[model samples]
Target chain A: MNKKEQRDHWLARPATVKRIWRVFVALLALTVLAQLAVSIKGYFGLDGWLGFGAAFGFLSCLVMVLFAKGLGYLLKRREDYYGGKEEPADDV
Target chain B: MMFEPIPPALALLLGGALIGILRGHARSAIVLLAPLATLWLVWQVPDGVALDIKFLDYRIEPLEGSPVRRLFATAFALMALVGGLFAYRQAKWHELAAAHIYAAGAIGVCFAGDLITLFIFWELMALFSTVVVWCGGGPAARAAGIRYVIMHLLGGVILKVGIEGIAVHTGSIDVQPMLASNFDAAMILIGILINAAAPPVSAWLSDSYPESSPTGSVFLSAFTTKTAVLALILLFPGEPLLIGIGLFMVMYGIIYALLENNIRRILAFSIVNQVGFMVCAVGIGTEMAINGAAAHAFAHIIYKALLFMSAGVVVYRTGLNRCSDVGGLFRTMPLTAICGIVGALAISGFPLTSGFTTKTLISQAAANEAMVLVYFLLAAASAGVFLHAGIKFPWFVFFQRDSGLRPKDAPWNMAAAMLVFAFLCVLLGVAPELLYRFLPYPVDYEAYAPDKVLFYLQLLLFSGLAFFLFLPLMRRTRTISLDADWLWRVLLSGVARGAYGALGWIGARLAKALMRIGNRLRAVAARHMSTSPDGRRSGVFARAWPIGTTALWIAILLTSYVFVYYL
Candidate 1:
């Protein structure tokens, strides 16, 4: 690794990166587990179940990501798809 | 004699005009001071049609004040101030002028007491925002500006027709609460929806906004759709059709945003999604829903501008916009990164952020109405928001695999503007009552209930988990996602070319047939008129055989003349 990048930032450390990810995952677990203790009063019949927020939030996002990936196959095109010049004459 | 109050929008308009003429710090000073002056003037307006004048035969109220109107005007004016602060150092002088005039148009819409005044201000906005888009200064910007103006002008024309219809049919030009049940009202609703960036016609927002200059976009994001939300709250509250339309917009924004690659275009799509929440609340049309829509509109202007400002800085420094081209910027651009994350969290409705306080109100309103399906879909869309905008934006643009870019942080004025908005995002969240006091209705909802916070935390954090889990799928491709604009940009143009070609072929055949028929007719005329004894071509009167015939004709004419004289 280059010396400049080595001293660039603490976030560049592999150990520090791993530690941050660990803490983030732990927080995610805590939010889900807290739901067991506090009953979520959902207006809809199914949403009041335990971990409903976590499950619904995760699953819906999963669905959206999958849908988007599929849509990209259909709708996504090269940057110059509309025949606009590949390089903009000026930065905006 | 008492002096009449001046219209507040006039302050910004005149400031814009002066900015065009002045140079250096004087122009910058006007940019900073005009919005503050307008803000003061906005407060001076008393409720209920503060200024009325007669135009032609009709009485028009040019300045009206109500809590909601004042609230929207305050937000717009503040946006002009902060936006001017951000752009003064970098944007072209004409860009700054156009943006201020655009701001004036939005503020004008807020205080318009009658439909005619509203329509006039609406067209004014259409005129100047196009100038802002053109200020991007490229062929792409030029083309996109034309398309954007066409869309807005089309909407303006539709709105004008509807207003004229209402005036002629109902004998009134007053702005009042109404449903879109009749033809005129439906036209008005459609017109406003186009501005709101509603689906099918909504491609204009995403297509044009990202093409604008970095500073221009920060201004662009704040005004157009929010004003439409204000107009909706004022005119079409409680319209049932809005519910379905709003739901479609919410989902449509999520899908398009998820697939988007450009940093600004992603945010642009999310604007549609965010406005969807407000449109849905207006559809609900309860007091709480109206308040929610208004509050969300205000909060949205701040946070969305914050996000755009950060994106603008990234673009300004690196001269790159695609997520694929830049990353690991947080190492050098710490302030910009942090503020961007703050804006992202606020948009995701994270606890202790402005988005949570405002967005939850819309959800709660739907629940209050027992709209089970809507509430659930909104919940899903909320998670979807975090996925596309909250995590994806920051993850791709700042923290993804390094593309070896180490650009400097935001310039001082830009940083200051970001700080101001970032502070407001938190301030409104921590003490939402500061915003709530100004709502059109009395406040009743509690945003920070323990249970509500817990539920939102769980929802958003888990969505964060999904973002990581599905990170591989979102690998930025140097590409763009096609939108409804493709229909006009590609399909429509192709159809026009084909029609022209077909017409040319038919025209060639028609010309050939006409030439043949002309020749035939000329030949027949020559046979009758010019055949001589020698079978030579000659005029009938010039032929030698005509001498005897002419004498006989003279004799016959003399005889007829004599007979007529006898009679």
Candidate 2:
């Protein structure tokens, strides 16, 4: 409806926003349904959970994110951590 | 014409020597063709030691051929070719030359038949790659390169010591797999892991690689660590300690990658992550696992280089590489975006990509060995790989909130190089048999069985969902996460700084005391005897003792001697 709204990505032009959201939701839903396709009886003490792989993947990511945030609190520093001269900012 | 059997490494090493003299089209053609010529020689190498010499009662072999060796050599040669193409137009002749020598060194390591030859090639790779890093030609590059060489030189000394011990103790220099139960083996393993960017020293890869010029980084990404991986596969495979080491590297890479803001550093971390799979596979030591390790290394160099090339293109155009400084670039740089996305998906191990085909074999081996913890951890790491590198890299650099930058797509040469590797990434995924044929063992595995595919899709896609849903958490910050390198870069420096301060303080206090002593002596001198500042002495006996004074001294010496004799 307004420029600021578009910038904020809320109340977008309905058709475009709806189409993208529909695809994202559909794809996520498809992953859940894929569990039905593959019967995953887990080994390695992670037994007895249906669709364990999906849950594990999702939960691991959440924990890692949370851990990274906690780690960032301690380890993250202003770019000057290495004396502010490092040029390329990415780390693997 | 000179007629000597040239080593395959010389094709690139010598070619590197000629690149500067050659101009324009000749340079590009030579750079592009040198790898092919080297690859051709690589294939011509016969099984077993190709060159041998006697050295102080030990046999040193410089070249050897085997499936695993050829596999590494082939990937290195191909990396050189594609990397050359990607970089030819952008990099100066010297950078390309150094890169060629660097690639040659990696290939040299792959074919090394003995510890001595391996060490030689290893040092060559070390020296030339440092040159490539220094070729960035700025203070950061210079400093990072210095630090890089320091790490490698330390590792090199440790490696040389290990090799010497192995030679003296084992009485053989052949590059055969060994256990880490002995001091020599343990030392060798540590030496190789340092180069592999394994824990406690893993930060060197992420620390130095990102500081190189965009093109230089692509070559830096390929050679040093993977050569170390190749060394592991050859010399230390099946050592169980590597399992723990590899797991540390895997988690370290993923976590650091998550916290990193620089794009290439993220890729550097992923290199450690990818190499972890190889290292862990080597620890498995079974035929399947070793093959998996070798195969994974082959696939990794291509995709990893592709990622670097894509990032290089970004830097080449925008002069910026941080996720914080870059976003929403896909609109104009569609080709780069697509290529980058392909590299990302391949790294994430999505179905129909090279990672899917290769990385699973490692986890499968873990499961086969009934290593419950290892299996589950590997699976989780695969998901983490996707999270840190797969979605995070492309999302921030390409599709996030528009930075309103319309940088052009990668130049044709770069685009072609990326396309070639991207094609290989998909090709290997779709038809893994092509690569499996190159493995040391026969292929009897299925990568795309329905159950397996379904499970992987579930794992990977859910991780992608997590990346998006946690978008707020993934926000870039103007910060760096401290890693193992901090021990040296920060703590060691800080310690040295403190030591210097203490030393300075002691020196200052000592100087003050000396000055006070000097002033007291001067006052005494002024009271008893005096001299002009110009050295016209007006003080008593300041110039010299007279003959009479000398005779008195002799009389005192005689009297003291007589008294001592009488006593």
Candidate 3:
């Protein structure tokens, strides 16, 4: 198959969707477990140490989705961000 | 008896000439060996005056005895080795050749005991690295390279002026700590800050590095700013302006990296951010803070180069650099993915990374000093690091939604280089002593106490938490963030055009006025010359009679002179 057909086939595969879902769930579970661990650790008077971490991990994923575009804007350049012709000659 | 250390200047001169003579793989071999030899020589140098010379009636000491200088020189030499290895397979022979020369320049700066030697190597670095950037071999790379050269050359000129002024005033060229209170010292500070990618000119790092070839970026990231940090440490340690400058660079790097989309550009911005930490540490100027700066520079070179190498692998394999075009490569390129993540985690200052060991000392020092605002800003900047580079880079490049590209794993050499650095990052993190011993200050800070590690993890993770909770607010992409350099690159370019246009208009008007005045003068002169006693020609000399009237006038003048003298 050509490149387009191959790409379409891959995208349409149920396995691909399932793998993506698995990743999402795994991330979620990891975040939740970390939060719980931090809280439990905090109960033993270690709140200053672990609480912020659990919270930050959860927050990073959330922010990745929320500010995905804004973050993307900051990091994104034109495909040829470094490419372009010199400015036109000025008559003046 | 007197002892002398191996002169770093000799190494640079010899290595640069040798590399110029070699070809292809031989060039890479020479480049790799040069730094190692320099490192060995640096170690062999005894703790005494190394080399001193007299130039232009001033005593120029180009090599001095100092543990701090030794540490920075060691790092630069190591950077050349690994950076050479990473670039060996793919880069052009000329690039490899020039890069070694560039590395030699950096080493020269690090080992420079005085300002004059530092200035010589400083311009050499600017020249050679611009060549490396131009090695990308495209219109964009060429244009950016020219702009890059112009900026650095301007910086070099400023530095030279500052050095000369200081020498004239102080009668010595010995490199010493300077406070930014007077013209000469302030000029030096401004000059050094420019190379450090300080605000107003910070855009050059991001603007040019991404234009470099994949391997080129790895080499590009290591030298320029770090050399400036070395200079700052040597010349302006404890100056308060550095504190503000460092903080500005830290936030500026993060915010811009957040908005940047190119994989390499984000890494480039993080270079600025990481250097900011060192600058701040230098400004603090305590033993702990200086030690932190030294250790952090050592760690940063390895990990940042690792991060760039992994990204280079991706770009090399698939020819994709934009985040929007890349995703989910973790499925196939697992090694690159893992290495990239390791680099990300290290940069984020995760518990078992090199950053954890080095970065903490600076914050701890600030806290000890009771500088509450600085402490808070640095903490927030640490969070911002996580939000921008740590999470943002890996997420978009490796773990975001699949873009369905099945590139092969990184080449064996690339993998080997990455693995070495990745292991080093962890090794340094876990065993800070290996690096601490090389620091200028004796190590007293503990990196692994339970309370400190736990506190750091919580602080960084909450920043991560903030990132996720506000993901909706961060959705924008594919745009360039404005930086202080925009004042010159964009806004000033516009202003320059307007000024030129106004000047042109005014010049045209002035020329026309002058021409009109000349025409009127000529008309009256012509009218008078043409008229005689009654509107006819008065004499031939007035209009067309040349020889006869000249003779008559000369005779009249001689007679008049004789008459006047007789009277």
Candidate 4:
């Protein structure tokens, strides 16, 4: 394909095409496997399992994201909600 | 030495003055030279008091040297140099000048041997740093600068009160590292944490910094909070409460950063997050932990400045700071993209980067002390840092679906400054010993073992993995998460407005009643006056009083007076 044609084709891929994302998932799986291959000393005895590193990292991130989302529901406000006529601070 | 060297702070103070007098290229020369001069002077002093004076039955030490002091002072001066280089081409003359003064104040605090001098320099930083914010030159900048100044000034007052309390109680004012347990110490701790952007009120950093000009944020990232870190190291080391406080800030930064849309605001939150590591280390209070805090700070200033410079380049070239607005600039602005990614990786503690070398020391300290929870939390925080800043920043700004932004890379000076700091990041990573020599304590540790590197990689990469997996959940929104500052920015203002409305209503009612009473008084006066307009009223009361009535009044007054006198 011509360069422009290829650019359009790349953009035309569906959001759920799951190609690049699949590679990332594969990497994650490989890493979790690698964590098992290595004999790593765990500071917290509970975190010394086969996939503990990967699980802990993933779960911690998941929890943080969820907690942050919860915070969003309670704390998030329209950009201009602080005052009458959007407060002209930090929007710069 | 043949003669006494000038105090290091003057290099910037006087150099900035020279910049004010000179213009154009000459001023730029001073901008670049001042920090280098300061760095040179930083190394000359021996580890003892350099200047001392007595004032009103008190001794003040303005310049003193120790390993920690030299470490912080050196890093600050280096930051001034790099930040100055990044700014001189784009910023106003006054912004550069004020920044020098701001940095000078920070340097002064580093060398302050007494609390009173520390307080003086602390307020000095608050003053000129606000001026730097004001140089941003917009309505938003103006308002943010005012809020920024108010927070710092209030912090300054709180610190002053604490200092006075300590002085009165102990009859001494020497600056010493101690736990923040007593009332005076607690106040000082709170005051310093306020400047550190510690929660539950860290929003000021995010609220004000992004408002600065692109270059201004670079300088903003370097001095104020880091100075607070230095102060904490000097004043409140080993305070257990800081562990909780620092961890809260760590989580707060990550969460808010994920929710933040503005590019600079995310970076601001990350600053709080990074400083939280130092705060935690201080609480650990071991020789290794203190060493870790000081080393981490040195490395952090460089990497953080580089990150801010990258974001600044984006804001400067595109005048767009929202993550959703710009991407895919690697085609043209390759240098900026690569440097920014390097910064992100370094901040993520990726192996072979400065963050890896420095941040691990703190975690190690936790482990050595057998604080399992602190260790785990620090590890998790390291992952979160990668998620919010390490990957998220570059992904959104440089590599996400092309916003078709093909703006040129940063200007030569900005590029040069980034390159210098970026090189330092890797150099320190590859050769940790170079940085260790300057640390406050004797070094007996290694940062990069094979297992440690593996674990950090697994943690960070998995965090990245989770990031991409949960990408939908991390979508940017056009809103702000209400922080503790909301109490002042939103709730207090709302209350004030309500009070004002109530007062207006009461004022109107009061005016009406007063008018009614005034009208009645006018009516009575007319009835009593001889010059009444109504003829009947004049006949009844307003007519001239008869001499007999006047005599009766006089006789009654005289009789009462004479009876009182007799009694």
Candidate 3 lDDT, B490-559, residue by residue in tens: 6788899999999999999999999999999987776666555565555333666668878999999999
Of the two candidates 3 and 4, the one with more favorable lDDT, higher being better, is: 4
lDDT of each residue in B200-230, candidate 4, tens digit only: 7798899889888899999999999999999
lDDT of 3 at B326: 90
Ten-residue region with minimum lDDT total, candidate 3 chain A: A83-92
lDDT of 1 at A27: 93
Ten-residue stretch with the least lDDT total in model 3 chain B: B532-541
Reference contacts recovered by each candidate, as fractions?
A: 0.78, 0.65, 0.25, 0.59
**What level of docking quality does candidate 2 show?**
acceptable
Residue-wise lDDT of candidate 4 within A1-92, one digit each (tens)?
45654554353344434687777778767766766567677676776677777777888999999988888899888876754323323423
> Which candidate has the highest lDDT of all?
1
TM-score of chain A of each: 0.81, 0.59, 0.32, 0.64
For model 1, how does the per-residue alpha-carbon lDDT over B62-142 read when each residue is reduced to its tens digit? 988899999999999999999999999999999999998999999999999999999999999989999998888889889
Model 2, position B207, has a per-residue lDDT of 78
The residue ranges of model 4 lying beyond 4 angstroms of the native Cα positions read A1-38, A83-92, B530-536, B539-541, B545-567
Best-matching candidate per TM-score:
1
How displaced is residue B528 in candidate 2, in Å? 6.0
The local distance difference test score of each candidate is 0.91, 0.87, 0.78, 0.87
Against the native complex, each candidate's DockQ, computed on alpha carbons, is 0.71, 0.45, 0.20, 0.46
Regions of model 1 farther than 4 Å from truth:
A2-5, A89-92, B1-3, B521-549, B553-567
Candidate 3 has an fnat equal to 0.25
Residue B406 error, candidate 1, Å:
1.6
In candidate 4, position B483 carries an lDDT of 87
Estimate the lDDT of model 4. 0.87
